[model samples]
Target: MRIQSTKQLPSLNELKEILSQRFSGQYSVKTFGAGRKSILVGKSTLIGAEISIHKNEVSIASSPPSVFGGILMTLGMTELALFIFPFFFKHKSGYRTLEREIGLFLQHQYC
Candidate 1:
C-alpha cells in the first residue's frame, strides 16, 4: 500500500517514531538513497518489511504470512455458487494490517 502527501509528509524522524511505535518487538532501519528499509524482530525471528519513502508517497510491503478468504456474495454469484460450492478457497501472503495503521497515522499527522 502507498500513502501520498504533497506538502505535509511526515519527516523522517516522525516516520521512524511512528513505525517504531506501531510494530511489536525490536526493529532496525537502514537508509539507502531516498528510502529506508526496516527489519523487525520478535523473539529472535526476523519480520522482514520494505518501506520506501518517496517525495510524494510512501510504499509498504511486509514479509509475514497472510490468509485471505473472499467470496462474491452478489445475487448472481450466490446463485452460481450453489452449484459450485466447493470453489471457495483461501490464499496466503504477507501481512498488510500495518499499512492501514500507518496510513491512518500519516493522514492524521500531515493531512
Candidate 2:
C-alpha cells in the first residue's frame, strides 16, 4: 500500500525511531540507508513488511506467509479445532492493520 501526502515526510532516522518505539518489541524493525526498511512481526521469517519512502509517498509491501510458515501456523491453530478458520481471518486482518498504521504514522509525522 502507498500513502501519498502533501506534507513533507520525516527523515529516515526519525522514521526508524518512531516505528521502533511504536512496535515496542512486538515486531522487529530495521532500516537501511536511503529510505528502506524491513519489519519482522513474528517468529515466522516470512511474515513482514518492506517499506520505502520517496518524496510525498510511503510504500508498504507485505509478503504472504511462506508455505512452511502457513503449515506451521495451521498446525498451531488446529488445537482450536472448529475455531481455526476465524484465526486465519484475524491474522490477515491484523497484518493489514499493521500496514495501515505504519503508513498513517509516516503520513502524519513531521521531519
Candidate 3:
C-alpha cells in the first residue's frame, strides 16, 4: 500500500514513536535504513511488513504467509485434512483485516 499525504510526515524515529504509542502491544517496529522500517503486527510473526516513509509519501509492503505455509508450520497431517478449508479462509481474511486496520490508522494520522 502506498499513501500520499498532503502534509509532511515526521522523522522516522518520531513516526515509530507515534505508531508504537498508538498501536501499543499490537505491533513491533524496527528501523533498518534511513527511511525504511519493518513491522510485525498481530499475534503471529508469520506476516511482516516493510514501511518506507519519504517526505509526504508512505509505502507499505507486506507478504502474508500462505495457508499452506501455516498448515505446514502449525498442524499435523490429521489436523490438516480436517481443518484445511477453514484455515485457508481464516488466514486470508485475517490478513485483509490487519491491512485495513493499518491503512485506516495511517490515513487518520497522515492523510
Candidate 4:
C-alpha cells in the first residue's frame, strides 16, 4: 500500500508531475487538489494513488483495479463485496503488478 525509497523524494507537486508524465498518456489520469491525489483509469481497472509525507518518507497509497466496477457501483454493492471479501480484490496479480510498477517507478526516479 505504501512505497518507500532511500532516494530523495521530490515535493508533492514535483512528484505528481513526475507521475503524471508517466501515467497520463497511458491512463485516464484525473489529478485532484494540487498533486495530492490522482486516479488513473485503465481498461478494466482504475487505480488511485496519493502522495503524502510520512515521517521522512514520501508515502504513496495506491488503490488497485476493479473489474466491472461501474456495474458494481451502479448496483451499489462494491462496498459490500469489498467488506465481505476484501482479499478477493487485493489478491489480483494485476493489482500487484501495477503496484510494483508504481513502486519501481518512484524508486527508479528518485534513486
Error of 1 at 109 (Å): 2.0
* Residue range 6-102, candidate 3, lDDT tens digits: 7778877787788778878876666654434544344354454556676688877664334444455465346565766565555665566667777
Better of 2 and 4 by TM-score: 2
**TM-score ranking from best candidate downward:** 3, 2, 4, 1
lDDT of 4 by residue, 1-111 (tens): 565666666665566567777887765444444544444434244443444655446555554334365344444455566463654455456555666667677677764
lDDT at position 73, candidate 4: 40
lDDT of candidate model 2 versus the reference: 0.63
Residue lDDT tens for model 2, 18-109: 78887776776776434345433332444656676678777787643345665756665677646666656656666677677776776666
Error of 1 at 32 (Å): 7.1
In order, the Cα lDDT scores of the candidates are 0.47, 0.63, 0.63, 0.54
How much lDDT does candidate 4 score?
0.54
Worst-scoring 10-residue span by lDDT in model 4? 41-50
Worst 10 residues of 2 by lDDT: 35-44
After the best TM-score superposition of candidate 1, give how far the Cα of residue 69 lies from its true spot, in angstroms: 24
Looking at model 2, the pairs that clash are none
Residue 10 lDDT in candidate 1: 65
Query: TM per model?
Result: 0.45, 0.56, 0.64, 0.55
Q: Pairs clashing in candidate 1?
A: none
Reference-based lDDT, residue 53, model 3 = 75
Q: Across residues 1-111, which tens digit of lDDT does each residue of candidate 1 receive?
A: 677776655666666666667553644443333333442212112233456667877776653211112223232256686765553322112234444555576666655
Q: Which pairs clash (backbone N, Cα, C closer than 3 Å) in model 3? A: none
